[model samples]
Target chain A: MARASVTRLTGRPLLSRRQDGLALRRAMPDRLLPALVAAMTFLAALALAGAVGASLLAQRWNNGAAAIMTIQVPDADAPAATGAGKRGDAVLAVLSHDPAFAAAIPVDRARLAALLAPWLGGAGGSGTGAPALSLPGVIQARLRPGVDPPADLAARLESAAPGTLAERNQPWTARLVALTRSLQACAALALLVVTGVAVAVVAAATRAGLAARRHSIEIVHGLGAGDGYIAGRFARRTTVLALSGGIIGTILSVPLLLLLCRLGAPFASGAALPPTLPDGDLAAYLSDALARVPLPLWIALPLLPPVSASIGWLTAQFTVRAWLRRLP
Target chain B: MIRLDEIALRYPGRDPNRGAVLQRISADIPSGGFRWVLGASGAGKSSLLRLLSLSLKPTSGQLEVLGVSVNRARRAALARLRRRTGTVFQDLRLLGELSVFDNVALRLRLDGLPEDRIELEVTEMLRFVGLGRKLDVRPHSLSGGEQQRVAVARAVVHRPPLLLADEPTGALDEKQAIRLISLFEELNQMGSTVLVATHNEALVRRFGHPALVLERGRLVSHG
Candidate 1:
């Protein structure tokens, strides 16, 4: 009869060495505080890195292409008799002839007035006073995604239209680019630091665990349990603690990120909320929903806990084994 | 049965300043018999018990247990033989984290006894040691006398043919000491060979077992 089946039939499975080990573990004192501390420290580091990294990745990939530049050219200088209509025709002709200029959409007068309403103030209704003319003859150029305007593209445009100055509006793009890069670098450094700290903490904890269990290890040797059995127990305990700590740490850190996004909104411009980037959208919308979602906790949080816990458990096992060799 | 013919055990000098704990010594323990080893501290009485327990090997000489020459024994075979002989350590080798029941069950567990059999044997041993009520309690919670009983229970629970105790009753009061002795006597009556190493001359004198007396690492008398 099969051993397991026989046991099930008899209602008492024969005791195996494996069952004895489990029973022994059940009888042993569980050092919860040390185990929990080791776990929490390990977990917190991972959660910190995970949350920041997820946000950075989302921002980099999703909202990455948001800031765009548009240039406007009113119809080419019209005849002095009907300057407005003729200038518009000339501008359209110049845009059609230029190779650097890909797609130029002329904005009508009403739309231009609406676009300038925020800066110029007062809703543009029939009764509203005529707004001060700001650059009457301008051509609007929309650059392709990721395509940097050639240095001479601006110069050529100015040359095409006398008394017109070509501006790239480079300040906002430069600032956004700098902000994204800075966040990425900061996230990377934070993760590295967390990993280093977890390793050190686990190593110290392993050493302490070995010291406390020295007598038990010797007892194990005396009982004829070899290095493998002894090591297995320590490894099991450490690994469980690390995984638990990781879960708790992840739970704690994600909400902080959501709060930070909320605090930062007033300072950030509407342009910062770019539609072309999904990450930007996530940062904007998911920050609130995921503020409690804890997605990054699940993703980036296991980095150091397993490594640290494994190292700690292994160190304790090998050290005790080496000590046992000197006992007899 | 254990035979150490012309066995010479030594602790190698770590430096010129340090000396060997045991010099070469020869002895034999007959099968299914009881032997008591006597010596003062530093006389290597514990060392001899360690050798017999197979916890230590002779620096030189032939060592055999159960007719198998241990010098020629493979590590796996050595472990197997060691598991068959239970030792009661002088320091009382009880895992403090484990309950008294589990500690006693360890020997049977090592021998791969069935769980039901292990429980039955552990219960019987605890009853014999007067720790039946303390089965679920840990060693640290027990008094020294009670702890020594737990250790004795652990050693004899598996019914190893050879049982070696090093100062098994050192911490017990006179009454408890007598009880511990009677426990060993009961094991000896059950066909298990017993060797006890102790400096307690009064107990040995009263018990009247054949003695192996060691003086300065040498076997000075056998009676």
Candidate 2:
């Protein structure tokens, strides 16, 4: 008389017996649950990926920004460039002598010219028939970890080499950190909302399914089937459906994710670009402005299906048990 | 065995006040007793059977079935009580998608009986009810009499101590009805307490079993 023994005798699995006992008919059209779950999971995966990427990008930018300083020497008094060169070399020599500074390198004219080429038009220098622009001499410094440059270091450099300014550029780095944090928060919020909506959708469908099978359920209950027995059947069915939909949704999202990655690849790979650029190099400038996400973050995408399945299973169990309490 | 003490069943109505379906009704059916509940249509015969089967709670009375005081039984206890009894619904509530064999085997399955025993018992019961050939057929595909037989087989396949049938022969022809009554008699002789509720007084009179009569939701006679 045990259900297990009966299943063994009938050669039907437990799920088949439960489903068959409920009289599988088109009485309940539940095609929507899986589809909805799949769609939600797809959206959730994308949001999760975005949040992870933003977090990693923020950390990278914070570390990179914290360890660097820039020194700009203007050519206001020198003959078009000689005075700027001497002041830049003087600043580099000063930085090199400090034990706290790991490296101090001067930016060559060709590299500086190339950096200004986007705005001035053509290649570095005046060779590309672009406007002749007076650019400053720049020195880049790398500091040892935990080393704070002396607060009076910039004043000392300015007094020794006139018309030169020193900057740690912490404010810009702070702004970038804040922006990435906001983006990560938004992505997390979106993920939570999508998962909640998916669970709600499954719960609603389970109720409808129970309503359609109410008569059969009553018959089974009258015949001595326990509430746990009935609820297990529903939970199993919904779990399978939700898991399938989640996998499909996750699989479908891969192409979209790849396309997004491709679109942002150029920006992620390049150095920071100026705010304003010539009309022709806008794509390149945009590419340089964005950072490519690291590979490890993709691992989280595969976990969505199982998470969705667990949610579906719990929702169905709760819905069925609550509904059964109202029965005789 | 079944016992009722001033059992009153009142279904909630759209209006705030409605009379009980069965008011101040009391009766006792001893073990192995074959009883006929005779009444006109809507005389609460089905309602009484539902109470005996533990499908409904008495509004203001006590009920005992198979030695268990079911009126105050918890859900799990009621389920155990239900398992000891079998009911043949008036509408023949066989799962339409299941084969006749599966329908009859369901009761034994619920009891967690072994597969070989379920198969042997279900097959024998179907054969006794003259439905052996239709074992693989769905209930919807069977004739009315065949469907009734399927319901009867399903009810008694597990050999429960109490068997309650509500208008089981309503859909049968005279010859088929007699055959069904004989089958019930055979089961009664095997020591199950049988209660058949029907509006067909002639059939009840012909069998001449100990009987109860209900009139307008009240027990009018027990003889």
Candidate 3:
């Protein structure tokens, strides 16, 4: 009879028959493989999320750093003819004329005092009822893109307002950028290591599976099944296991990633809270920290499952083929 | 059809002085020919079948099956050649987890036959072997005789041109053995070249087929 006739006669699809005929996998149960894969995928997703979050945070820091320029007007203590405030006004006026400066605003004495309030003992004045400390007049400037010849601008500003110092914010910005880059590199390296571990875990599991099913494999081989056929079975099985595990791991990691961001939120947004607290209250400390990451970083989290599934599939295929070659 | 010339098979790590399993062995099996291979225990009958099945390569010498040189053929070609030959192992080798029908249908499936055709042929073959009612039963659930029949049905279900049975009747009673041998005879009558290896010399004599006898892994007589 023609092969198609059997399907028609049985009223079953070819795929069902093919699956039913695969007695080897049924003969061997894989209880640990899926769990291992899931755990690996979970760790991998977390690492990937960390890398993406670092990248977004770094970009934000770079943008903020690039636009800022600070000018310090040292207090003269005389408070009379051409004081620090006049010098600050002169610097702002000079910056306003240059196309390179987007905006130049003076920092008021009150705002400066508030910034130094903690160090100066209190918000109103010194704690011992002494007069409030005199602070320098500062100018905050925003520079336009591609107009960052800070040295020339600083020299011009210094000449325009004597006793004033023009400081380009680029040096500190460069250092912060370098630090973020290093963090990103570390996250990426962690992700690579996790992926390698995942592959190794899957490979080891596949080898164990092969050893367990050696008898059935020999029967199939003796029955004329090719190595490709055997390897394809293993690949499909491992891929399914890995895909399920990856989905589970990815799902489980979302809340963890969110909690991480929340914990870091206080630092990222520069929100103020008490620096000193009762020791050993970890939960309370974490509760005070909250952070929000960009939506794109969260969106990238879903791709981990498929990537992990593909890795599992390829690892199984390579393992099976290599193992079979060792046999007669 | 099968051909062997000066084929020698030795297990790896064995003493060299012990000699090969089948040293300088040579034989020819013609198309549609039925032959019985007689030998004592450890006479290398299974090893000879392994060579014919393309599961093992001769250490040195020439072998061919279905007109393809085993040593010279590519791996894919050898697989194709194997597909054209059916073997009933001494151990039966029935997958314990699969149903009897699935065990028989595996051969046809490996040939890429459609589901409907596999079901039809497997059912018909099972019925022919008196196993029509045990289609969904696993091999381990069946009696030893029933499992042997399942193995036989599996081997011949694909209608291969050559069929090899290694001690297929070892687990059968006198009546069951006779029935199984008749099944082999019926298949041979249908133009399949059949080879049966057995220790039952009386049955061999009564069936009156051409016989090849082996002693200590050497072909002693062939007629």
Candidate 4:
């Protein structure tokens, strides 16, 4: 026959060496604190994930179009101010010769129509033989590193081709950086708040445990157990609870994080992932999905438990020690 | 030895007259001395024991237990002194969650005694108290008399130099109470200072030890 179980069916280890003198197991129940801590850890994980995601986004934007500048010439087919070629061709020649820019790519009418297809639906029309709206000639060129975008480059372009306008992308790049920094700051603040809340949760749970076991505590204390002994017991218990909570919270956050990374993968890569997945290969899909999360996050997720345990240990130690001052 | 000089205990409050528990009481007991603390229910016998056990700091006074000045001792020093003392409460404050053996072994364990030695000592003490078969039994499972014995066993298991019992056998029958007192006498013979507080004049007469008598928060008699 099964024993009439007084203790809840816990996965307590079969063999034990040390004894719990205070019987803190019954004094501090395992459920409420760990559950609350797990919730806090989950929020912390998300906050950290957000910070990491913002960093990756900043890197992507920095490496992407932020280094490129654009030059647009109106009335491109018209005569150039230089009296040598079409205005658009003149502007291209000047840009191509300049050491500051590289890989000057001229946008043709059909490509221009495709670019504008979202705004002007007629871009999808008739083979694009001279777009209905007379679009300016658009030229994109990568700005080489250490290349000072000459302040007078726009004037030079205007001289080569009348009405040519140079759009410096540097300000927008700085703005993007500032935006990402703001996002990272917000994520950092969220992380600090979450950690603060986790500490508070552990502290409150510890106080409750102390209150619930006042008699037991008084007995041990009266038996000559020092503040360190009593506080150490509470710290050990809370550390285990917080560590377990952190591990569980981190584990639970993984799939959700993976899904989020997968959804945001297109924004990072600047293109949609191909839908044609190979059939009947679950491992392949899982590996692919795992690859979506950043390597830094992989390293960081495993650290939450130890960090959480440290917080719990420190919080319980101080709280219990402070509370014991009321005893003697 | 224990020394007290004009010790007073009072609950801090606006009304001074209603708060004093033990007041202007001074006494001394040498090493290896045994004395019964005589008082009524509302008298301050328990509070005096609480002061000796280092669980309560007197509101104002001088107290020295086991040669450490209770008034000036650091908390850590007091804890060390407390480790050298043992107490058996009237309520038999056995940790309900622990078994009889563990309750008896708590002080030794806290002192970092070796497990094998602790087990041996706790087992012997339990047997001496006639609860040898109930080593693993919880305190609540025992009868009132048996529970008092457990408390007594725990108090003396470490052979503390200063043994203080606050109504130690208040719940025991005459046979059980006498047996418990004999245990204290045996410990006192073994060179421990044992102080038992009780209102039972019959028990006091049976033991015929010197007594410290209190009335209305004052030490009324000592012989």
Candidate 5:
């Protein structure tokens, strides 16, 4: 309410132009120094985890359509000995007639046999042996694209095929989803713990500064400077510390995260493919998802460190302001 | 101009019966004059200063400073009033962390004076107080007399219309007290109203000035 001119409290300005760099350096000892290394390590871990979790969720969400399971039913007259012919007919009848099954397009024998060629060794392996040994009777039906298979769909299919068992591919997908969520929660918890520690450290340092400068405040008051002027100095100092510490902490965490990500690349690469894609070429799976993922992570992963730093700065500012209000 | 009419003050204590520290007592110190309020320990001299300085409001009377009715003034107006005056504490409240030059420059700077002006004015004041050589030295490193002078320099730096000094030379030798009192006289000559609360009778006789004496929370005499 007091629209007075902005008063400078001393010959020294609140923030010097060129001296900001020097001030930032000075801030390191008081604010940034202690938390710098820890903050970096914590933030890097947080960012990497966040990137990984987000990527996993996005990958799962994006790849919702790719979770395919096929049951191949053998030909009607292949033989009655393996019970393959009867089961194959039964599957065809259910898929075509059951209203619950919107459309199940059966693949031709040649295509199904071709699909299995790589795993069963189509012809002869260079000096290895013949490809086909024995084959199981299975009905491969491609469910209507983009339609979610219901929980009871498997039961219905099993009932339809009297002697056949139905298998759903979603349980493994659900497990992967749960793991991603758990990792995200763990990262979030660690970030919170680091934030708490940062605030506590800054608060303690500020209190010590206040105690040392108690006479400075009293003298200013005695010289007719009010509470606002005294508080302004403290708020400015701590804020600088918070921001600088954040920057330093973030800088430190990046390289550490890169190293860890590099080390974990092999395991993550293996996870991108299904066991059914039995060629097992590491390069193929690497190309399948890893390439798509790193870009998203690279773009989004760098944001966490700065965000953590801002949290630190904000906490320090509020704490100092609250402490100053108690002064007479 | 400072006026306290039928003023009363009290501090929270162990006993409730002794409610008011200074009962309904009225006093005034006119503008452009020096007034030495003489009182022994616990005689409420400092309480009067507190009331005049707008540090504490009187419980039961109207008070004014520089023709502004402080009792009815807004918080902003009161702060303006406070800024227009300066008080040197009995404890010589100089910011020990800052150098002597900085301590003196504080008041002017708070009023938003430019850096060059602050530098010139602070230099002049430090010179006047004979601490020019020790400009960059912090107060805690200074001697008792030098520290008291720095406190004086800070109080008078802004050249406020009103000045309050509580035992300004309480820790000084007789010669130093005389020099300090002369500075106060010079300020008064320049039209700043001066009020000194002291018990130093020898110093009072040394520099003959009008005096107001207090005893047992009551005004004993005025001259």
Candidate 6:
């Protein structure tokens, strides 16, 4: 046995200070287990972000993109076969009157020409540079919730003009929704695995602590220390360590989360990406990206320390109590 | 006070024939009575003291310590019973990590004594054991006789109603042995039931107390 300093021992205020007689500071060290927990927390943070992001994306796509139905009326300026009004007018009247369609707005000619200018020459579509060629009219229609587009919509429009196509992106939107749901499920599974691994890590660490302090524990037990007293020493030590690990992991996840937010910025805000800058604008980008991390994630990330501490405390309590059962 | 009626302890996973270390042994010690546990090596003296101190549950039969039945008592009830008892092991099981003061204070701390009371009691006990100046020193820094006194101080610091000592004077000289026995005698006179196990017949004859002698895990005589 190495000799310890007498003066240091005497300097302690009372014998009550090291009430943890098992010397858990020496038995269960503060380093390795927290590091493992920190790694687990980091993965957990990523999984949480994925789950939240997938859910938000699904909701936005469902409400905005999925409900929109576009109907294109080509040769739009031609007279109606009913010979009463223009072909585009006939189609617009049918969509606006239908209760199944919530709203419809016809895209005017100038904006339509500018939109088609990319495929046709700019002068050919604009009447200013040359005689304007016939261009399809686009009407972005919104479908009412749980309502299907009438199958006869294109047929009714064709009565007015030979070819007017009603195109709905519903199939593609459905596929995207399915994809995001599975992504959320996968993220949820990852969270479960990380949580399990953390519990196991804490359990293994606690068992090792018990083994290291076996003789001291038995001696203390012989001194009439109850099972609660022994288990409390371990549980308190492990909880502090786990909390430290969770804090470290949360701090480490910040940069990663920020990067993911930046990558996802355009889709979330429905804003166009900024043209390339020399990163003098990086601070602005960073601030914007930080804001994009959901409120729920902000709330959830800070809670990791407490959550992990709870896990560590409960696991250590159960483990130590069960281990003490082997004693007399 | 202690009472044993056919108490037996069998540690499992040993040589099958030698496994039952103490078998159907019986004895009764009145309150404040002193007894010298006499046995040759492998004669189960330690095991008997172990049972008396509530360190081992008897494999079968009855043991009543401090008027509480050992086998039938709940774990918490047994713990409360154990706090009333103290034992000085042969190996001097002092926690090497703690100072002498802390070591002696451990029992009172377990009893939830107030901080000032624990300090006062531990200091007084260490001084009584003649280790007052070495209160802050670790057990390993003490000599063998000093360590033995420290163990004795810790065991009796709580002033338990029951005290058991096993080979307490094994490493002590004749004078030190007499001094240790005198301390036990004083504690016994103070109304503690003290039991000492020893292999020293000369010391036993010198002290001249009743002896419960054992041979091969069986009590041969009590005279």
Instruction: Give Cα distance to truth, residue A197, candidate 6, Å.
Output: 1.7
Candidate 3 residue spans exceeding 4 A from truth? A1-31, A75-85, A122-132, A265-291, B72-74, B173-182, B185-191, B206-209, B221-223
Candidate 6 overall Cα lDDT vs. reference?
Answer: 0.85
Task: For residues A267-326, write the lDDT of model 2, one tens digit per residue.
Answer: 443444344445779676445333333464467777889999999999989999999998
Residue-wise lDDT of candidate 6 within A1-328, one digit each (tens)?
1113332434455534445458898888989989999999999999999998888788778876788888888877778878878888888888899888999999877787777777776654574655456567889999998788888877776776778888887889889989999999999999999999999999999999999999889888888888888888899999999999999998999899987866775776576665443367877777777777887789889998899999999999999999988887
TM-score of each: 0.63, 0.81, 0.86, 0.87, 0.69, 0.87
lDDT of 5 at B10: 74
lDDT of 1: 0.65
**Over 4 Å off, model 1:** A1-179, A203-217, A228-244, A263-288, A291-298, A301-328, B1-18, B25-41, B51-84, B95-99, B109-114, B127-149, B160-162, B168-195, B198-213, B219-223
User: What lDDT does model 3 reach?
Assistant: 0.77
Candidate 1 vs 2: which has more DockQ: 2
TM-score (chain B) of candidate 2: 0.95
What RMSD does each model have against the real structure? Answer: 7.9, 6.2, 4.8, 5.3, 7.9, 4.6
Each model's chain A TM-score: 0.60, 0.78, 0.80, 0.84, 0.59, 0.83
Report residue B116 deviation for candidate 5 (angstroms). Answer: 1.0
lDDT tens digits, residue span A129-150, model 5 = 4334434345544444455556
lDDT tens string, model 4, A1-328? 1212211121222123245456778777888887888888888888888899888888877765677888899999898887888999999998899888866889776777787788877844435554677778899988886475778888888789877888878788778877987999999999999999999999998898899888899888988988999999999999999998888888888878987777778876666774434596767877887888888889999999899999999999999999999988
Worst 10 residues of 5 chain A by lDDT: A15-24
Each model's DockQ score:
0.22, 0.33, 0.43, 0.44, 0.20, 0.40
Error (Å) of candidate 3 at residue B195 is 2.3
Error of 1 at A142 (Å): 5.4
| Candidate number achieving the greatest DockQ relative to the actual structure | 4
